[model samples]
Target chain A: MTPKKVIIADKMNQFSDHWNPRVIGELNGQQVRAVKLKGEFVWHDHDHEDELFLVIKGILKMEFRDRTETIYPGEFIIVPRKTEHRPVADEEVELLLFEPASTVNTGNVVDERTRTTLQKI
Target chain B: MTPKKVIIADKMNQFSDHWNPRVIGELNGQQVRAVKLKGEFVWHDHDHEDELFLVIKGILKMEFRDRTETIYPGEFIIVPRKTEHRPVADEEVELLLFEPASTVNTGNVVDERTRTTLQKI
Candidate 1:
């Protein structure tokens, strides 16, 4: 099958909703996703999956139990499995996420923000 | 362990060599790498691994047996397993690569450019 190149900015413009991630690329049982974030996310941790968050626009505050990391554009943070954390964005932040396909947005928490099924853009 | 955010640009500044990739982050069984590319790469294909190349600076020409795809900054292309391809860059190009940890720089062929052991930066 022929593979196509994905333009991150073009995909980001396809969605504006916060916290919902859209699948853009998939390979090696992992998915590359694009999501927008504003305000705060629930504190949670994945039991078996690690998540990589790459900032595309604005700043992201990744809060762990002990400290919060401010990630700017061109920066990325890998939240290890079983480490409870939260993501906070004072303003809308665009991100590209890399993780296993089984990873849930809300992780271990089944909150209102939990997304079991994601849309592909 | 406290997870640290990796500044891609800062890590990129640490290396200037072409074609050699340095591991920047790893999650699950996958590795995230940063590499600078110029000229042309050998035509090769992984038997079991898919590779993702995201352009960060300059332009990348991904040549397939059938056609060529031009990838720009903020753009990415996935080379599926068993698909012979080559990467050509007229000028220096910065890139982020995601693939399995065991992936070699030259797949299916061993050349002087083959990197069996990759360094982590």
Candidate 2:
């Protein structure tokens, strides 16, 4: 297989959807997905794998049930497995997420925010 | 446990060393490290886990035994497990690497290039 080098933002423009992550690359069986967020993400967590969220652009606020952390463009936060966290953005937010290939945005909870059909490129 | 937030670059000034990666955060069974590189990294690969390299400040060139790829700021590349690769930079480069917490920079092969005694913050 030819090695993949992903310029995530450049590939993200090909689609126009919020919350749905498009799988861009895989490493060590882990899938790298880029998601676009506008308003708020569902309060969810993956119980099997940890989720890594890197803010590509704009400010992102990750709100837990009690505490919240605001991430800037150059900042990133890792939501541990089973930690109920909701990501919110007052403005448009671009993010790069790393998790297992089977992980869903909302994990096993099926909802309007649950994106299971991940696109691979 | 107090949640850790790493402002990578802002903390890097506390130390001055190339190739030595500082353990910043860990999630699940993996750890997040930030390393400062100036010249060229050794031609080596981790046999156990894939290496994720994200360019934080300058350009980076990851050379493989067969092909090579250049990564610029905001770009990332994942070197698969056991894929012999080396990273080169003409100027100082700031990078963030994510892998298993037990992963050594040189991964079992201790040499002059290998940097051990990782600092935790």
Candidate 3:
């Protein structure tokens, strides 16, 4: 199969809902996803998956037990596995997330915000 | 340990060399790297690893054995394993690469352009 190019901005325009992630590309058992965030997320941790969040638009505030990190556009942060954390956005934020294909959006927490199945863009 | 934010532009400004990639962040046995590319690269293919290339600045022309793909800023392409591909740039291109930690820059070809040991920025 031929590999295709994925335009991140175009993919972001496809979805308007907040907190839902859409898979854009995949490679080597890892998936690249585009997600929109408007408010706050649940505090949780993945037992075996590491999450990388790259801010595409606006800002992202990652709150951990010890500290909170403010990530801006053109910046990224990696949250290691088994570390409790939360992501909060003051305004609408666009992000690209990289993680294992088996990762769930809510990590260990199974709440209304949990997304076990993601749509591919 | 607290996870720190990595500024993509700041890391890009640290190195000026072309074709050499520097590791920026690592997670789940995968490495996120920043590299500068110009001219043409050798045709090579990783036997067991897939590579993802995200264009940060300029444009990248990925030449496959059957077709070619032009990736632009805010766009990305994934080269699957065992696929013969070469990346060419008419001008200088800055990129973010996500791949397995064991992946080599030159894949199966060992030449002067091959980089086995990479520096972390």
Instruction: Give a tens-digit lDDT track for model 1, residues B67-90.
Output: 999999999998999999999999
Interface RMSD of each: 0.6, 2.1, 0.8
C-alpha RMSD values across all candidates: 0.7, 2.0, 0.8
Question: What TM-score should be assigned to candidate 1?
Answer: 0.99
Compute each candidate's TM-score over C-alphas. Answer: 0.99, 0.91, 0.98
**Per-prediction DockQ, in order?**
0.89, 0.52, 0.88
Q: Which 10 successive residues of model 2 chain A have the least lDDT summed?
A: A1-10
How do these models rank on DockQ, best leading?
Answer: 1, 3, 2
Cα-based lDDT for every prediction: 0.96, 0.80, 0.96
Q: Which regions in candidate 1 have their CA more than 4 angstroms from the true location?
A: none
How well does candidate 2 score on lDDT at residue B112?
91
**Candidate 3 iRMSD, 1 decimal:** 0.8
* Tens-place lDDT digits, model 3, residues A1-121: 6698999999999999999999999998999999999998999999999999999999999999999999998999999999999999999999999999999999999999889999998
| Strongest candidate by DockQ | 1
Give per-residue lDDT, candidate 3, residue A18.
96
- Model 2 spans > 4 angstroms off: B1-4
What lDDT, from 0 to 1, does candidate 3 have?
A: 0.96
lDDT of 2 at B82: 80
